[model samples]
Target chain A: MKDGPDIARIASLVGDPARANMLTALMTGAALTASELALEGGVTLPTASSHLAKLIEGGLLTVAAQGRHRYYGLAGPQVASMLEAIMGVAAGVGPKRARPGPREPAMREARVCYDHLAGEHAVKMMDTFLARDILVRDGQEIRLGPNSHSYFTAVGIDVEKLGPSRRPVCRDCLDWSVRRSHLAGQLGAAILDKILTEKWARREKDSRVITFSPKGRQAFERAFLEV
Target chain B: MKDGPDIARIASLVGDPARANMLTALMTGAALTASELALEGGVTLPTASSHLAKLIEGGLLTVAAQGRHRYYGLAGPQVASMLEAIMGVAAGVGPKRARPGPREPAMREARVCYDHLAGEHAVKMMDTFLARDILVRDGQEIRLGPNSHSYFTAVGIDVEKLGPSRRPVCRDCLDWSVRRSHLAGQLGAAILDKILTEKWARREKDSRVITFSPKGRQAFERAFLEV
Candidate 1:
């Protein structure tokens, strides 16, 4: 038998419904207080605290204490990707829910997957990049081409400055909603941050959706799509 | 909170250590009996039965009864992929084990991942396919091009007959051992099966390792590599 890493401990941490909900809520890339996560998970504060403690101890999440409150977020991008992978498998294998949430449409349109963009808009952006030869796949690795530097620079993201990090510059992460690949890694996070900084889109309060204004949509298309 | 499929329930099924060991043992893709799994998991037969029942009920596994013996295996490829993904994240996050198992090196060299091959050999095969243009990646999708039809057909896997399945013909599954993409789909399964049938390799009893003879290894490289 293959003796790999112990997966049961980490999985069991996410196995609880309330903890799963808390982790899902954190997929927005926002740090939330224990009470807030409790509300998000539909559990009491004590219960949420216990779960959060377990998650932090399990290394799937990290916490920071600021002033009177401690905030929790996913430990890093790996945790987020693992959660997304789980969601992908769960979508295909598990039974469908009877009633979809109100945020379903918005989430399917655009949402924050960890620190990057996901859903339809993200998929469209990825396709545009691929079609334009801004990104190329060398085997399983996704790398930015010579043209990508100038293109990202024109969009206010300094691709040069994103180098030297332990994190990859380009990564293809599976989108749970679209069942397609989206941009991830340092470049992915930078692009999403640039989009928000430009006011082209804004993340919905207390949710994962990224809502775009009409002007913002037009601007995004003119910049990314028209290429 | 978006109520998609319940991920926690399925994750919890994989959370228990005994169950996790059993599932890991099943990664060999062998239909093992309850007693075998119990021995592998270091659990009593009755306890293994309970865990197996829970896994079956949760749709993570399926069982078949032949005569007085009941055999259990992963429900489908999705389950196996989910487990691999979990192992990936766990490897990164979890605490390291004190002593590595004896089979660790061999498993990393060549092993069965569900119905497909994984580890170094599998990665090499995938790299060869990509280099030869037998398998072309169009964005996130891996497609067999014009050359692949003849190439696979010559290898005894009729590419034409692999159509019409809900499952994909070419898939890029991340190899947990290699941290690279390997072929996984109908074509992947077909190639692995061919190796076994040709006596090029045989799955080690009660293990995931696919032991290849010296002659078999030479033949495999000649067929897959020197293209």
Candidate 2:
């Protein structure tokens, strides 16, 4: 066998249509149960179990026990990034017969990417951060700006208490729909978590779309968009 | 058939072992004939032909005839970026039993990523550019710095006439092995083209490893690493 990282194995695991559906559903960043995933994937429960087993075995997903039920989520942000990149290519090269679904517009407006916000609203937040110097790019990496600590703390994301992790504090992920980028990594997740916790936005039921109330949207703008 | 981009079709194309090998081999940015790809993929010519046809149909690759031989290469930069991203996830989630190949060390030191240089040397060049303010990141986008035009022209890369293309002038590609970023996109390709044209390095036969002579290596450092 030619020696290198095994690309074929991972690609094969994701190549299955049912599994692809399941994985995409998990991109909402929510840990879902097998039955829910089966429904989303349009596969039987047994088939879903088998697919989930393979995904877990491949490390593309992680399983956790909540109460008497087990829930599945993407392994982490890296897997999400990989899947997003794949979608970018798929969108680029797929047959030109695409017909947008009813949910397409809402999804393109705002959605969850793994654990972070994505789409138009998310892009705006990232732009505001950069435009106001809350975050700056150094080389290819996004670094905390001079006032980032103060800015994030002001928004209830205590930078000092983010704890330690191998993941960067600030990173950017390409938005496939817009061909732009939104914030990702730990800081991005924190911002998203804050949004949901404060009831600024709520994830639409059984979907990745995030819906913000009029007041919440205004509050979000005041907090993240104000220079 | 489900909604959104057709990811399964594209992932399935990359799923097959032979096809995955073929795609990775083409990531060197050199167009190879069916026979050469067959050798790289460890498959028979007929099988390689079948795979090549499928890849072309899928838009992951493009073919052109040079003289009597048909050479196949990746369709474009987007395809290459997709493959690199896939490799990143593969390396992340693959089995932990990786044993280095004979050429692994050399490859990790320096390799070609599609039309650009990758690995350590490429990373250093990116760092130097940022440090010297020759390239500045403006909100996840790399734009020309004050001295960028002059610096690139001094190095024989005319910033004015790169031509109008949808491709970004500079983008950062994540390096899987190092968990760092390397320069990619149009400017990146130009630098690589210049390096090869100037005989600062030569591509290894039958591999992606770039071999820079002792003097060439020194010159590269002096030019890029100099303050």
Candidate 3:
């Protein structure tokens, strides 16, 4: 209470079950309305409205009112980064749940990060690119190195048309389940699309996990030198 | 269920009350042991152990066993990112909490972020520097621009002695509370330290909130130009 507000404010805002549930729903980065969140959190609409108010007051979220429907989203990328940092500690510190049976191994392997791919394999893919000089770190953003131009060009990425001003590349989107960086941004979306179209990876119904077909595995190995 | 396992996987992982509480504690970015977390979550050690096992097996966490104590943390920065995304959604979509009353207000204004200064004021300070051509963004880092050396020198920051390779001159640390980037790195730390030393700000124990005194406010206004 003595430390003005800052992290404590953000922390307390995230500490509650209803609020946490609402935030978890927003993880996909899409804007949602109040009633939808109320159902997601299993609370009444009025109660959800109060919670939304607190979050906005706390500066953890922003509200966009379009006529009768008001859409809310995270205030900015910094909020995402902070939540990620906390999730890291939570995962590290919490007790693990019990998994039964032959364990759906695919969940542990690679998964979708929002709309992109992430996991041990994803990290390996990133590493392969780095080793091949396909991508280089440019401050917080990753840039497609000059050497990797051919790979993208071969894959039909049309990097030349993107021009020099716009950053036409992939960003390291952090994967919660896989605990590694996955390709994000325009390139990431394109890659995800390509995989789905080629039937290399299929999205599992009701979950973020992606199951790779034998053909997909082979393709991934061939395309990015999958580790 | 049609979106594959991504939504369900993330939601179920965070659905449990005890696990959620444990995650709330870890949001501070500090690692804790299973027993410590057990106590915090109001669960038995064995129950905490089981949860920890599930989280680890689920690939949401990694463990570093030192002697008899096992230290756990989010698998990596990717996991952190995922968690943040989820939290953003929750904060955006959830119900609100009642106010706990103001115990301190100054601390909420500005404070140190890891190693640098953060909050609204810190962000404004960065803007000031950029406007004056005293700082330049270099991809993932910030460097002194053409006029920065002389500008900082006039402001009492020894640029020549600091050296170019010693540390990052400037970069933005994502501020969770403000959901914006704040000044980070050695320069940030220096400014924060100077503020505290000159009685411009004071720290609130057990939290990172910093309060600015009347004199401190005036000094900061004079030094940083209206931040």
Candidate 4:
């Protein structure tokens, strides 16, 4: 007897290419202006504006007035997670559009998944963490190991000082390309922040790819890839 | 540099109300005919046929020849999983369309999610299973607990004889209504099959609601809820 949630409304909002691009741009965990998003969506400013308004109305995004300009971001992590889940299904339902673009290789290697890193390196890191007992499975949830606080401190993230957040501290997100688990949630976001702040990788312009510098790649390998 | 997966295409397909209705109807894990699907979608046969063509072309569904008619079903488990994920996001994004219908109460009480049971009863059963250690967490996957075979057998499901399939033996699907884990995968499908076959619950026609007879309800509680 239940008529279920109205998935079509949200689905159609994300279904539009221009809006999808705008939303994907925000998944970098960075706020962007309408013009920037318009450029990313490959649409005229007016069209982009209309799309943005719809997105806000759809509850998929939020707008903030920083000054004369307005900054837009995904309303919350749920939007990003929803987008990623759709991507996973799309990857499986490959046809002409599912073809990998020129940047696909780089994206497959390393990319930003919402607030966290996702790709080959990210999946590998998840596997290593599970293997080393740095992350433990707690029923339906994943938890950080009891003695893994030192590991986080060494990587410049203070677990206790993550402040307050409604989201879980440790979460496992499905990586589209790898079809495996990737680190997500509060700690996941912090780790991505650390990587960028440390100059280990730089997020590409208007793209999800995160290119690690040669030295950064080596350092990342040494830290997470090895014991 | 990566132009990520084209989620917009699939989203748009499901975004259409008629198309979405048709797809959701198929989520019962039953193979429905074109005419039946047309009725569910609330569209004319011609319109439904065109829509079905697009869905088939889009790779969201599959068709099989049976006698003189064709039966449609979700392409695989991934489609069902993706639909549930979307439902989860839509549930959180309650603006106006998220309002519960009269049947919402019934759906919330007991319903089918794709191939398995969902709603209050389903979530309760999952909690009890985990609490009693009938289900164990194996990293990101859920596994059956050792010595729990008797419990499943008593419920009339033989895990070992579930037949070979690409899908896992046990999977945890997110329950949109409860925002909790519910059993899915081969074992889950088997349990649902048992439920219907044993007359524990009768699925409501043209809806997701599964109404349990009074006698059946008591038996279910004693079997899964009682120690």
Candidate 5:
């Protein structure tokens, strides 16, 4: 038998409908209060607290106490990615839910997937990067190429100031909607941040949808296009 | 909130300790009898059957009746990949078990990941393919280049015979041990099959380990290396 970390423990933590909802909500990359999570999970605050405790203990989530208020978020990007992968498989193989979200198409066009861009627009950006040789892929690994710095700089992103970090600079995260790869890593986050700062897009309140303005869409396309 | 498939339903099926063990055991890509899974899960035969039924119902597994006996295995490659991704996250963030298996080193060197090869040797083969331009990586997608046909044909993989399938010719599966990409998909399965058929390596009984003999190791290296 293969010896590995106990996946059951983690899966069980995510197995509950209430907990799954909370985790999915947290994938928006926001630190939310218990009340917010409770609403998200369709559970009471006390019930949400208990579930949050288990997730925190299981390392699936982390809590920060600010004075009397406690805010919870995903433990890290790995947790987010795992949830995304779970959603990917669930969407593919599992039974359909009774009520589908009303914003399915908008969500699929652009959304926040744990602090990084995902969905169609993100996939397109990734494709453009590869087509322009700005990002080079070697097997499973992705690396920023020589042209990347100039390109990112041209788009008003401080490529040099990203600084050194323990996290990988570039990574490929599988997009659930498109069934393709999108950039996910420090660079991915930086790119999303740049877009938001430039007013190219804005995340919808209480939702994962990332809506872009007509002008912003044209600007984004022109900026990230292959030279 | 995102309205998608009910992830909790499928996850809870995998959440039970006994069921998790059985699923992990099935990760070897071998279809085993209920009695075998019972032993793997350290549960009673009836309990194992119940859990297997739930997994099958949840679409995480599938069962086939062979004569008077029933054999259980993962539903498909997607299910296997999902399990692998779960394991990857579990290994990274979850609490460590008290008793780590003694074969950890060997398991990490070369072991079966579902159906295809994984671990060190598999990562090396993927690297060689990229270095030789036999497999081209376009961002998150991998494509078999012009050089691929001749190279695979030289190695006795009837490239033309692989035929058209819904599955892609190449895929990059993230290796848990190496934290890198390894080959997967139809072509990956074919390479592993070729290695086994040519007596280059043999899978250890009741385990995922694929041990290559000294001579076989040399032959594998020479065969995969660029001219």
Candidate 6:
């Protein structure tokens, strides 16, 4: 990747209209092929390839070559952060008169991010644990507090078992939209997966929104003390 | 805000290359005029005017008239967030490559977020306070913990007198770079202002970067245990 004095290079890469469209498609966090992205961006295959090359060269994207096809994604968290920071400002104005319609209320209320729980419900659940002294904040790290181990057991989740997997049992995720902390680690992700597997929530098609089922509504209320 | 089926209208408004450039310039957080932003975006005055009008019409920008010139800025936090979200995807592949250099280090260290604090230093500062029981996070709200009020008093800020102003004494700002909480709100802004006023830190001209003076560094270390 060009490390310095590459502003012109980076700018020109994004200055293209076709490339910008493809990038937007990937923003949803789904992996797609060059052909798929080309169609999404309304560009020819060769043009998309060129754009993908430039993105990869800039360290803004990473490409995984699998057999006859190649998949491209943002390079890393830093790339994502850069885009997020820019969006935070860009979202403020310009063609903003047409506000995106109100998100599905259910998903906005409670949902998942990647594998973990997020949105308002997740924040509230974390709040309940902290208020009850089940979790403690320690220097950008979250630790189970007091009788957290027993508490998890009482709640029917085995916190200890989560450690064996690469998935984290507990992790802190910053909710970009709400600008608050939400649970992400292995434990948190497991809990969300559990909810889905048990048919508590269903992911909205073509959207990140998660719709809670009737049973999920009752179960979540009981588990997390929803009023 | 239309809050209607106008994704195409909104996209077209943002879709133009030159307009996107002007918006990106404002994305850095400074309010700029037609002439200044035109130069930044590499467009002519008439072109800039048209772009600005579209942006303003699209509700992505708001203008504050100052005599003959109009200064445009992002309307609010939501606008900023939307831009960020868009660019989150748009920046995937720029045409140019930036050579990694010394300048990158300073940017990664500390920067400004509109009127708030961001970056690693701010994130760590907030984390330390939370870990040491100096601050507490309650859902989306941030508050001083058990002895935090006394601690603030002992440190020399007159929280009681400042009450008439009704400004929040402390707040948790989510650092865009670190993806963690940082101190913000009235107190965070005040502290930054004080540091600059005392010549402990200085802003890089035309940039969000902050440079700490030797004396200011010592003061920060003594006061906040900042490294």
- Candidate 6: list runs displaced more than 4 Å: A1-55, A63-74, A80-103, A110-216, A223-227, B1-30, B54-60, B74-113, B116-183, B199-227
Give RMSD to native, each candidate: 5.2, 5.2, 10.1, 4.2, 5.1, 7.1
Using Cα atoms, each model's DockQ against the true complex is: 0.49, 0.48, 0.07, 0.51, 0.50, 0.19
Best by TM-score: 4
**Could you give candidate 6's per-residue lDDT for residues A184-223 as a string of tens digits?**
7777766787778888788776555778888887898787
**Per-candidate fnat, comma-separated:** 0.67, 0.68, 0.02, 0.63, 0.71, 0.14
Order the candidate numbers by lDDT, best to worst: 2, 1, 5, 4, 3, 6
Q: Which stretches of candidate 1 lie over 4 Å from their true place?
A: A22-81, A96-106, A109-117, A129-174, A182-227, B1-5, B65-69
Off by over 4 Å in 2: A1-3, A98-118, A125-174, A180-227, B1-3, B66-68, B97-99
Give the local distance difference test score of model 5: 0.82
> Pick by DockQ: which candidate is best?
4
**After superposing the true interface residues, what Cα RMSD does each candidate give?**
2.1, 2.0, 8.5, 2.3, 2.1, 8.0
Each candidate's chain B TM-score? Answer: 0.93, 0.92, 0.63, 0.67, 0.67, 0.74
DockQ of 3: 0.07
Off by over 4 Å in 5: A225-227, B1-4, B26-46, B62-73, B96-103, B110-118, B125-174, B180-227
For candidate 2, write residues B159-192 as lDDT tens digits: 7777588888888887766656788989999989
Which tens-of-lDDT digit does each residue in A1-227 have in candidate 4?
Answer: 12678888889998998887787778787889999999989999999999999998888888999879999999887778778777877887856654568888898899998789999999998888888887887654789896578777776678988858788888877777887778888888888888899999999986788999999999888778775
lDDT of 1 at A91: 67
Give the candidates in order of DockQ, highest first. Answer: 4, 5, 1, 2, 6, 3
Pitting candidate 2 against candidate 4, the one with the higher DockQ is 4
Pick the lDDT winner: 2
lDDT (0-100) at residue A112 of candidate 5? 95
Candidate 2 lDDT score at position B61 = 92
lDDT of each: 0.83, 0.83, 0.63, 0.82, 0.82, 0.63
Instruction: List, residue by residue over B43-142, the lDDT tens digit for candidate 3.
Output: 9999999988877776667788879988776565445455555554444433342443353233336765544576778877877887777777776557
lDDT minimum window of 10 residues, candidate 1 chain B: B91-100
| TM per candidate | 0.76, 0.78, 0.50, 0.83, 0.77, 0.60
Instruction: Report lDDT (Cα) of residue A183, candidate 1.
Output: 87
| Model 2, residue A197: C-alpha shift (Å) | 16
